[model samples]
Target: MTCRLCKRDCQLKNSHIIPEFLYRSLYDEKHRFYRISVEESEKSTFIQKGVREYLLCGDCEQRLSKYERYASTVLQGGVELTVSRDGNLIHIEGIDYVKFKLFSLSILWRSSISSLDIFKQVSLGPHEEKLRKMILAEDAGRDCEYPFIMSPITHEGALQKDLIIQPTKTKLEGHVVYRFTFGGIFWVFVVSGHRIPSVVVSASISTNGKLTMLPREITEMKYISNMATELARKGKV
Candidate 1:
């Protein structure tokens, strides 16, 4: 494959739907449902494939995949981040942590904008409202179990989110707040459409060798790729 952005003989690249490391044990580690109301689909066809992609070659994926552990301490609680798209910037809002939790909490996707949602059957774990609050407050060092929350931060969204993260105190539970800073994928999803193609899940190749059902990550690179192709078609990422 050719590089989706540079078109320089695209090689497989590291595709991060959301970095695996940031969530730590908090990771879902399993499948779940996220629901999206049909308000955004009135004008287009709904994508049936999962959303996500590979921006790395096999070797690159292997190398970058190991870095997730280094940044586990960067995010916690509700977060608000933003992604500024050039042409891909559709109508959207600044990041909202509460909305992110709501969107990510359940994994059902529906055309209805109400409580109609579902997920694959599964067991459960203890609630982490306290841990969630700790992460928001940026208090990882107090545990001594995991430290060094810097160094491996990754970029996200069209604006290249790593460029815009700053620390702020945000409320998570009642009277509970987190002090974590925003970096990497922090604000990108907040600005993207939740009612539309809300939560991106996975990415993979189509049988025809083209990429399909890609999440916001692959779509970002491919959006740039598609634009360049159009320029050749239009003589003009």
Candidate 2:
């Protein structure tokens, strides 16, 4: 198929319906995230500006394949918490558990007031409620900045993740990280000032810096709107 964004005769990249960075930075204290205080926007400029080209295709992804390998360390493991009976009538916990939370965020989900307002917009609504339901499976972290969510799934592919903060705003407001996971499908949120182009090329390189997989999946999901409305509610203090 042709590229989705460019509509060219080439492959495309797996665009996170949200953005990957929103979750990837949770465990990584080094991503350097920034938040513009709702109160300080009038007096101060942005401390860290977001990237222009956040997501990419193989043509774009090749520019940073080595970074994907480091992500494995952040993809924490999971444990099945359900009780099942075997042929011998022995109670056993299923092994289909995943650690961490799946990642996502709306680049379009930014706040109109200030960076701080962004938090308020997300934390105080039905969105936060859904975010809470999803994250109930993870931890609150040391400062409770990182959000986490969990849900027991049957035998199937699931994802676990943590979001490290990439400070693009202030030196005082360090990065905020969180964890939220789910069953089936990988979701990535790139919290940025840019918007998704609806199409692009993407390729994957091995952890050893080798070109491995070139993904052209037209990344789309049905639960994103529902999840966003839910997750937005989670940003509340």
Candidate 3:
């Protein structure tokens, strides 16, 4: 099969749909993680590795890994990046607008193109090809083009950093949104052609390389709380 990202008829490598770094904290002492499903019919199970498939070739994988590496460093505070907190809102500065933005877009694009069951809901339709061209050309585009709002998942005033839930699709401010939670952060990407709310655009990565993360509690979201409870009941959390 042709490599999905580069579209070249070359040997495709086992590429992770979601960057492996995001799953590092989710692993257990035995080097395993629980795959929880909110649906009652689908029982939660344990997995030894992150989701992967033959999507990209060696060159394309390396190309995307650069962005992921940068993002992981910033997220893990490996760099001397300044992070400030005000009340419940957290602000991070000194980010590379291009690299960070591309990383976010890559997540959306990869999840959409992935055949993994966890990402089956991410059908981007026309936006899929558009994102492909943008990523291939290293065009992050305007922040408003595919704006995303982020929030840290907190339960009882503590951050939840060890769970990976199924991505969900919803509508926010009349814009289509896809929500993903992993590595203690909840990312909500707004995908639509119509005018997006300015409030939503401002929540995304700024052109000046500033990013904000608002805190959201699990108690406020019934679905997440239910899933957490189910996962805890079945496996070591």
Candidate 4:
């Protein structure tokens, strides 16, 4: 079979649609994580690993893994970041722009190309090819091309880890965006050909290795609250 990322005819590896490290915090005592899906009648389920498919060859997998490793370090606090706060907003600096930006783009591109049911909500259409080329060239592209907003989520004052939600796509400020939750962080990836919203651009990681995160509680998000309520009603959480 041909590899998806490099388009090479070779033996493909079981590549994860979402990097494996993202699921580490979600693992339970049995080394599994609960996957919650509002669209499914089951509501909640357990899995030993993140979603995977035969997408890339060993070489291509390693290439993408490099970016994933960098991202894991940053997200897991392995990298030194200069941090300051203004109200609830947290500004962070000292990031590797190329590595982190490519990592973010890789996730978006992978989800769009993935055939998994969980990622069905993400379909990049024409943007898919553009991203493929960019990733292949290791071009992070401009900040506004595929901007994303990230916020760490909390439940009542406590950081909420151990939860993974199915991605959902929606329109925000006249742009297409996909929402994902994992590692106690909410990600809103804006994928559009037109000019992205200023809010998204400002929140996205800057070329100077700066980023802003809006720390939020679950109660402020009605959709998340509703999902929690439904899961509780089903005795799943």
- Model 1 per-residue lDDT tens digits across residues 1-237: 753222346566535433433323322335322222223332222332232355434553343343333223213423233323335322223323222232222111111111212111111112233323333333322211111111112235332332211122232222222122123332211111122221221111111211112124524444234544654554330
Each prediction's whole-model lDDT (CA): 0.27, 0.28, 0.86, 0.87
Best of the two (3, 4) by TM-score: 4
Residue pairs that clash (backbone atoms under 3 angstroms), model 3: none
> Which structure is stronger by TM-score: 2 or 4?
4
| Winner on lDDT (1 vs 4) | 4
Q: Write the per-residue lDDT of candidate 2 for residues 1-237, one digit (tens) a residue.
A: 443222346655554323344344332255543432324223323223233332334653442332232233332333323444444222323221122222222222221112342333332234333333333323212212222212222122223232222212211123222222322223222222223222210211112221111111112333333444443555411
Q: Ten residues in a row with the worst lDDT in model 3?
A: 228-237
Which lDDT tens digits does candidate 4 get at residues 42-111? 5567889888999999999999999999998888878888999999999999999889998988888899
Best by TM-score: 4
Model 1 has a clash total of 32
TM-score of each: 0.24, 0.20, 0.91, 0.93
Q: Which runs in model 4 stand beyond 4 Å of their true positions? A: 39-44, 230-237
RMSD, each candidate, Å? 22.0, 19.3, 2.4, 1.8
TM-score of predicted structure 2: 0.20
Cα deviation in Å at residue 1, candidate 1? Answer: 0.9
What would the C-alpha RMSD of candidate 1 be, to one decimal place? 22.0
Candidate topping lDDT? 4
